[model samples]
Target: MSVAVYIAVMAGVTYLIRVIPFAMVRKKIKSEFIKSLLYYMPYAILSAMTFPAIFYSTGNTVTAGVGTVTAIVLAYFDLPLIAVAISAAAAAFGVGFLV
Candidate 1:
């Protein structure tokens, strides 16, 4: 198939996926449970997509785990994002050097 055809198919699928939800739901959602699920869905999806990559990013699970732990601990203490990131990276790099 040509690239244009592939692009068109992808665009159509994306459009349909976005449109179907609106077309099916004509009124405001009222269920508290469903509302809570929807509210947290994006964070859940992002974590699902991102969390596993953390484990494999350093090419060594031990370093990756140490980095993840460092990041989590720093985040728990409300450290700045830059501090958390740098500390995690340093922790990973230091572990990678040692192992």
Candidate 2:
């Protein structure tokens, strides 16, 4: 019920999440399937966390969608990160004014 209790519970859960893996896997992993799963897990988790937030970030789905599309297009073209970010923000800002 208290904040300290919540924080302590969270800390215990986080510690277990990190420790359980190390405790379970002591030898080099030989399975390609498992290896690939581990390799892609971070990206999958990051996308899962990030994708939904993108649509709600600007408080307007239209502007957020425009910005997301702009970012995706620029990233696909392998544009510089700075250019992609600024262009996305500008696109979102301009769309915000219109919509």
Give all TM-scores, in the order shown: 0.65, 0.68
Please give the RMSD to the true structure for each candidate, in Å.
Answer: 4.1, 3.1
lDDT of 2 by residue, 15-48 (tens): 9999987888678889999999999999999899
Query: What clash count goes with each model?
Result: 0, 0
Backbone clashes, candidate 1: 0
Question: What TM-score does structure 2 among the candidates reach?
Answer: 0.68
Write down the lDDT that model 1 would get. 0.94
Error of 2 at 45 (Å): 1.5
Q: Write the per-residue lDDT of candidate 1 for residues 8-42, one digit (tens) a residue.
A: 99999999989988788688888999999989999
